[model samples]
Target: MKIRILRVFAAVLLLSFALPSVAQNVRYEQQGTAYVTAEDQWIADRLVDQAIGAPQGADAQVVFYRTHDQVPGPVRVDGGAGPLALLESGTCVALRLVPGSHAFVIDGRTVTVRVEPGERDYVRITSAPTGPKVAISNALTFLRLVTGKRDPLYASN
Candidate 1:
């Protein structure tokens, strides 16, 4: 039991250090739903467009993934216009965002994210009281899983 516990601890520790010295300086681009948001067709197809590799042109990629499995029901992700994708646990969805500040609408709250040119960012969503909360990760544990060469990452979670 001790060995198994140690292995689990090691895995979490390794994941925590995957980004090494990445400075987690998160910039929120919106405040209190006051910004215009993009309309994603998440419900029409039940999933967002999956991005396996780096984005093209001058856009940056943002991958959204859930952090926990406590929420048994699917979380509804919508845009300003209409319904978006329903997020399930353990799935990764990638979006090619233009190089600028963008707002992510979740759980009736808005989280702002700034995208840099030719850079890739990860968003980890967790359940919160009012709604789902999001944060930027400085680790590649999920990045690798999203961009894994062998397994194609889709909009599952």
Candidate 2:
């Protein structure tokens, strides 16, 4: 009986520690083509809604968007060379990369993408039970997001 109780207690303690690493629930509001955190929407409203176009003669454009899930705390995004952007839930960031292979590390999740010249790539961040799942998306999918096919949501932690 004592051994069973000890095992159960150990399991609970382990789960408690692991919970922080899991994806955090957050609320978001749509602002033009971007989704910004409801709590801090003002800060991102102007930046995301502005007519930020791809730079002239850029090789490729990559947009990392998190519309569904929120990341815990302020996570620094490492774009191979170094920390390039600070990301949180309900925020999106864009990068222009030379036509080549690159790896972007966000919240400890590494996603590798091959960028083609004059092409645009999209990545979506979704919430999972374990953590955030990063997947590559296409222009059509991003279009759906922009066209209001997908609905914005929030979850309570």
RMSD values, in order shown:
16.7, 19.6
**Sliding window of 10 residues with minimal summed lDDT for model 1:** 36-45
TM-score of 1: 0.52
Runs in model 1 lying further than 4 Å from the true structure: 1-51, 128-130, 141-157
- TM-score of every candidate relative to the true structure: 0.52, 0.54
How well is each residue in 123-149 modelled by candidate 2, as lDDT tens digits? 887655566778997544544455455
- lDDT by residue for model 1 (1-157), tens: 9999999999999888964434321111332122211111122112222436666678887777875567676666555566556778767667777888877786676767788997667677777555677777633345344444432333221
Model 2, position 7, has a per-residue lDDT of: 100
CA lDDT of every candidate: 0.59, 0.63
Q: How displaced is residue 154 in candidate 1, in Å?
A: 24
Candidate 2 TM-score to native: 0.54
Clashes of each: 4, 0
Q: Per the 3 Å backbone cut-off, how many clashing residue pairs does candidate 2 have? A: 0
Candidate 2 backbone collisions, by pair: none
Please give the lDDT score at residue 109 for candidate 1.
62
User: What's the alpha carbon RMSD for model 1?
Assistant: 16.7
